[model samples]
Target: MALLDAQAIHPITLPDGTVYRDTVYLKNVIDHPRMEIGNFSYYTHSGRREDTALILAPYLGHACRERLVIGKFVQIARGSYFITSSANHPMAGFTTYPFRIFKPETFGYKDLPIKDTIVDHDVWIGQNAAIMPGVHIGSGAIVAAASVVTRDVPPYAVVGGNPASIIRMRYSSDVIDELLGLAWWDWPLDRIEANLPALSSGDMTALRRA
Candidate 1:
């Protein structure tokens, strides 16, 4: 079955029969309810390596309520980090100083608004990319290596560089609309296997007819 299907849960078993472990081999991440990693999606991290421990793919979660939701068929390269929205201080028009922190009660919902980071299906995030809080990456978007994503990414768009800018759209608007409508990622395992011909190649004609 596609990894992020309705039936999917944490600790999904991979093609290699390796189970998805949180932070370490299926340890801390499995326990954390806020984290939602899709099926067949994986992250590669670079840090101190220990064979027995659960590898740390840094979530960079904030103190307030923040969430990281990644979709199916997503591929995250090593060093990719998510900077959640909860960590930001009030800086709109006002000074970027933390004057509110001095008063313990000032850290209320009004001061730090809750923003969740969401990455949609079939996205690819390259190495050392930093996704800012409240950034909603559309389905089939490609984040270029070393990119700092500060805003929302459109579906089928390719973005790169610091403060990530749009490189290009992978397909024409019509094609993208069709693809999004199809939502082939939500197909069942049997149907996916059966439609391999249309899925693998850019058989838009066949896909459209299907």
Candidate 2:
């Protein structure tokens, strides 16, 4: 319910020098009151969010929700697509009838089942990616551009390609596990700011120990 000032956050300036302003527009999905975007998130015109979502769209379509959870400090890029709903069709009989024509109470429209997706903190989703419903993206993961994510992405791993194959680990599995346990994104802002230099350097060791 509280509206934070967009100006207080830094703006994203495109290579063409165009600027985007609305924080709400940056996400393809959202919950409420959990957003913590950094300085340059941007969303193209084709993104949307559900509810109570936190987003950091440094490029485009930062956060997209589908009745799921996105943890703090996640970064998303431009041209990414997050799909939550599949178009409903009648199961009782074969009909191309419009949704309004069928009573929601009778056909189960009133109880359209939706699964919540979760994206943990400090994740990075690359450009032009697509995330399907009912999938969880773990903390500190990296999803490469144009990847089609059909399954859960493990924490601190790198995934890419049409079906999103694991390209490599950004760090050793042990290091990744340790960082997840550290959970630095949960720290207070002042504490995080004090360690900004190390965090920005991608020093997993320093971050984990900090």
Candidate 3:
């Protein structure tokens, strides 16, 4: 049998046979209009299952223009959240406080620029990480705990700290390019399962052979 169930809300099963309810497959639980979640992307949160979208991105509203696109096999830890483009206050004016939002008719900053946040496939975001608006996190990247990501993260990069600078690249440029081309995350479940050894062991030769 396959290890993961794409349809299951709670995907993690403990060694003792108990289901770990805190972790949920994001695609199954999230139903936001402006958010796109890929399969097997799981999030660990203690809140109610129905509140997944809100908890993950509190600033993103139903009517917001910017979208949050998360790709397949993303592993987001507890207390991590996204501050989307809609959350930004106007910078052109003298004061940052929004004066026009007081009235119902004048509410919202619809005229502001909207940039969608993209988290690519196989990204692992650590606990309490805050991804700033419009940041494009590349595939196979690892974000360290409590990092404040304000810029784009390169693929296979390990990023950490405030403003989220790249600590190191997981693989060489050539290898990274090859891996990106291979895109193991896009493979069928059976194919992925068959190549588990190479994937987990980081055996590039075996992976290429697969």
Candidate 4:
């Protein structure tokens, strides 16, 4: 089954009895009793969305705009911030109030387009990390705590710092390629569960063959 379809089955019930099936509400505004959160996703009071897969930690924040897209098996630590949009200001000589009155054509807003931030599968965002807008975090990448990601991150690389820099790769390039080829997340949950023993045994060869 597709990830979205699989997620629709499990509904999350909030404190007020509001049910959040997934982030489907993000597609369009809805007035349901519950917040629709996706499968394997997690969020905190700070407005961070760890959806598109599993969220493994607490203390994260509310996702900036429900449009934040996280991929499968993502592990986001506490205090992480994923910002999707930025408030634009008038670049030309004009009034700043009633910002909506001046459209992109009127000012330089046209130059600044809204870009969606995407965190690909198997990503690990450390605690207190801040992901800026338009940044694409490649699959299997790791972002260190308190780091500020300003650019796209390469797959399987470890990055850290205020202006996040590549510290090193989590695994050898060949290993990363092999793991990507494995594509375990695509397996049926039931099948994966059945083979959990083999997977957990650190036998990549077995997993790949499976």
Leading candidate by lDDT: 3
Model 2 poorest 10 in a row by lDDT: 51-60
Q: Which candidate, 1 or 2, has the higher TM-score?
A: 1
Residue-level lDDT of model 4, residues 29-72, one tens digit each, is 22122123223444332232334222311212233232456666
Runs with alpha carbons beyond 4 Å of true place in candidate 1: 1-29, 46-63, 92-110
For residue 5, model 1's alpha carbon misses the true position, in angstroms, by 12
Residue 205 CA displacement from its true place in model 3, Å: 0.5
**Model 1 poorest ten-residue lDDT run:** 48-57
| TM-score of predicted structure 1 | 0.73
For model 3, how does the per-residue alpha-carbon lDDT over 91-147 read when each residue is reduced to its tens digit? 998999998789999999988999999999999999999999999999999999999
149-173: candidate 1 lDDT, tens digit per residue: 9999999999998789999999999
Which candidate gets the maximum TM-score versus the true structure? 3
> In order, what lDDT does every prediction score?
0.71, 0.60, 0.96, 0.61
Better of 2 and 4 by lDDT: 4
Off by over 4 Å in 3: none
Clashing pairs in 1: 3-39, 4-39, 21-26, 23-54, 24-54, 24-55, 25-54
Candidate 4 achieves a global lDDT of 0.61
